[model samples]
Target chain A: MLLIRAIVRPEKKDEVLAELSSAGFNAATMVDVVGRGKQKGIRIGGMVYDEIPKTLILMVIPDDAKETVITMILSIAKTGTGGTFGDGKIFVSPVDEVYTISKGTAGL
Target chain B: MKEIMAVVRMKKTGATKKALVAAGVAGFTAVKVMGRGNLVTDPKAIEACKEKLLSMGMDEFSESWDTEKMVTSFLDGSRFFPRRLFTILVHDDDVPRVIEAIVTANKTEYGIGDGTIFVLPVSDAVRVRTGEAGEAAIW
Candidate 1:
């Protein structure tokens, strides 16, 4: 299994989630977080707000399904032509084990 | 690549960020989280509970009642404390530097709830805009 963590703008969270659900990858955990990327947060007026609100979406999928899920998220989360800063980045990690708490069954 | 996750005191987030930047880290993600360490009966923990109860209209108990006992009873109900979890991804060579920076900024003389640093192995990373992967994507 692979764990995909996508940090996207709050405005695009719903769209990304909906897209993933439509694609049959429904199980996901979303957390509201504050972070920054290469842009190092945005500056408005005379102040620099270093912490930007974002939605972190986490999902665990079969290894083979990684590309499809990532593509779906990227397509839905990107902003404007060629994408702008804060469009978000995705990190993929290996998941050694998964268990269904209610069913008492293992694997996803 | 490695993912360095550091859970530090809420008040030390600013110092941690500055330390990471000074250590040459480009970007990071931070989330507000609530967690508890092994020291369940720490005095500071009990004091925090008392303060919380007093703030929530339990001032009557503060003067006449055994506040410590009340706080200790409440401890079983609420043991978690607020913390900041910083998730930073850095190249393999930079792991030690990042770890050092986080520790330097968060460590205190008390040494109990200084927080934890976890270094996890990242399989891959992707930059959504340019379709880059691996090291090319992580910069």
Candidate 2:
């Protein structure tokens, strides 16, 4: 199994989630977080906000489905004509185990 | 590349951040989380608690230490403590330094719930706007 964690702008969260759901990935956990990327945080007017609000979407999927899901999120989460600095980043890591609480069973 | 996850006490987050930066780490993400350790269910933990209480001069409470009451109260949700989960991505070689920094900042004398650190292999990383991959994407 593989764990995909995508940090995207809050405004694009729903669109990304909806697209993933339609693509048959129904299980995901989302958290509201404050972070900054390589560009640091944004500066508006004379104010500089070091931590910007973003949504973190976590999903555990089969190894084979990694590319498909990543591509889906990349396409839906990007902003503007080409892409902007805060388009967001994705991190892929390995998953050793998973368990279902109510069923008391293991595996996805 | 490797992803280093550290769950530390909430109050220690600032010290952790400074430690990471001083260790040359570029960036990381942190989220507030609520969790509990095995303290409530472990017999050894209960004994340790009793010892600490006695050392603090709470002789009555320590002498009357009721395991059943303690377990019930903890299970009722009073056991959950706030923590900060930091997700850090670093080059393979930087793993030790990052882990060292996190441990130094979070470790306490009590050492029970200081938290846990996990190192997972990262398959890949991508910079969305620039389309950079691997090391190019991370640094």
Candidate 3:
């Protein structure tokens, strides 16, 4: 399994979640977060907004679904048709083990 | 070091933290989240339910809406289960100890929503407080 963490805009969250669900990938954990990427936050009308509200969607999925899921998120989470800054980022990490608490079992 | 992230029942948060802290795991971040398992995800069935709800003049749909809302709000009430996600990073050797602590903390005899723990490899880590990176940074 692999864990895919996507940091995306708050406004784009609904779409991202919907698309994922439609694509048959509904299992995700979401948290409200604030972050900035290469843009280094945003400056509007001489005001600097250092912290931006973004939703962190986390999913522990089978390794094979990584690419498909990432692509789906990218397509739906982008700010515009061609994409723009602050659209969000996806981090993929290899999972060594998974334990199901309900079953008292490990490696599932 | 490895990043150990666990999504557990909301009620288990306190106990899980105490166990990890007692185990000497350095630090962790816990976030409240809404989630569900794949077992409850049936797209076709969910769509039909969504349409039914909408036809009844339910304002569930806002200007911006997507399928996620349908899946997450399938039951109208308690559609998505509440969970607490704990993220901990520890040295590679400490993985077993940490997992043991978490399992012990989360284990329930009845085992309804014990939660799940995931162990992932960390290529590198950097601690900003002391300008440390790699193993030292994690400390």
**By TM-score, who's the top model here?**
3
Task: Assign candidate 2 its CAPRI class.
Answer: incorrect
* lDDT values for all models: 0.72, 0.73, 0.78
Give the TM-scores of the predictions, in the order they appear: 0.49, 0.49, 0.74
Better of 1 and 2 by DockQ: 2
- Kindly list the per-residue Cα lDDT of model 1 for residues A1-108, writing each as its tens digit: 787889999999888876776677765656678887787678899888889888887677889999999999889899998998988999998754444312223444
Count of backbone clashes for each model? 0, 0, 2
Kindly report the fnat of each predicted structure, to 2 decimals: 0.01, 0.04, 0.91
Model 3: how far residue B131 lies from native, Å: 5.4
Q: Which stretches of candidate 2 lie over 4 Å from their true place?
A: A1-108, B39-78
Q: Could you tell me the C-alpha RMSD of candidate 1 in Å?
A: 12.3
CA error at residue B83 for candidate 3, angstroms? 2.4
What's the CA error at residue B1 for candidate 1, in Å?
Answer: 0.6
Tell me the tens digit of each residue's lDDT in model 3 across A1-108: 988999998898888877887777766778888887788799999998879889998888888998899989888888767889888899987899888776757754
Q: For model 1, how does the per-residue alpha-carbon lDDT over B27-53 read when each residue is reduced to its tens digit?
A: 999988654433344567456646777
Interface RMSD, Å, model 1: 12.2
Q: Which candidate has the highest DockQ of all?
A: 3
